[model samples]
Target: MTKMKNESNLKVTFCKRKSGLFKKFSELITLCGAEILLLVFSPTKRVFSYGHPSVDEIVGPLFGYPVRRVEKLMEVEEQHGKKINHDKKVGQDQRWWERSNKEMSYQQLEHLKMSLLNLNAIVTQKMLEFSNP
Candidate 1:
């Protein structure tokens, strides 16, 4: 791709592209429970980032470790895809909340937290309505 010479055009493109990058990362992280640290700098040097849980949580492990992009991670995930789907199908057969917390993966636990929070809000709203009515 050629460098965008127009300053306004460059900034607009950067803004749009960074949003798309973060959206894809959000979807991928939600799908596979993959931890990613994406640090993006805009044309004006403003920082943009998105991290599941938190950026510190993902970055903390890198202190002693060397940074190596593992191609094997993709291959391993590809092989596990079918097994993961099968497991999820079986899991769906059982009532979801009935499953033990210890058996849940990180993403599952995050989902459970969000679900519980939403339930809490609904319960609180109902309680207020009932009391007022």
Candidate 2:
């Protein structure tokens, strides 16, 4: 393994090494019937995963992780159904103008005004910079 001094170099090296490692793992699984689950977290905290069958299927059963029950699944399905119905009702109930120009609260209006002012100031500054430079 080559040592990398810089963050950019390290990230590049990590990607190369990770790809090689996964290739070897795949070969091992195909030739030797070895079950494998590999999980690597990058320097940026992004996850990289490789598994023979699947990461969850092998790890969950081996580690005695709790599997979802029928009741829990039903509850999730019910919640999703409610959300879909509510969304449909909301879309159906509102007219085009009502949906387009939503009535903002006093606080929301003030927040919007301030945001617009800040954006205007930034644009003015950029214009001045461009004109001068």
RMSD of each: 17.4, 20.6
Weakest ten-residue segment in model 1 by summed lDDT: 64-73
RMSD of 2: 20.6
Candidate 2, run of 10 with poorest lDDT: 93-102
Give me candidate 1's TM-score against the actual structure.
0.46
Candidate 2 residue-wise lDDT, 49-127, digit = tens: 6666754356557645443542354355457545544554344542221121255445334544454344344334433
Q: How accurate is candidate 2 locally (lDDT)?
A: 0.57
Per-candidate TM-scores read 0.46, 0.46
Candidate 1 C-alpha lDDT tens digits along 1-133: 8999999999888877876787799789889988887767567854455556544355435543222332243344435444444567544634444356687777667655654444344334433554675
Clashing pairs in 1: none
Compared to the true structure, candidate 2 yields what TM-score?
0.46
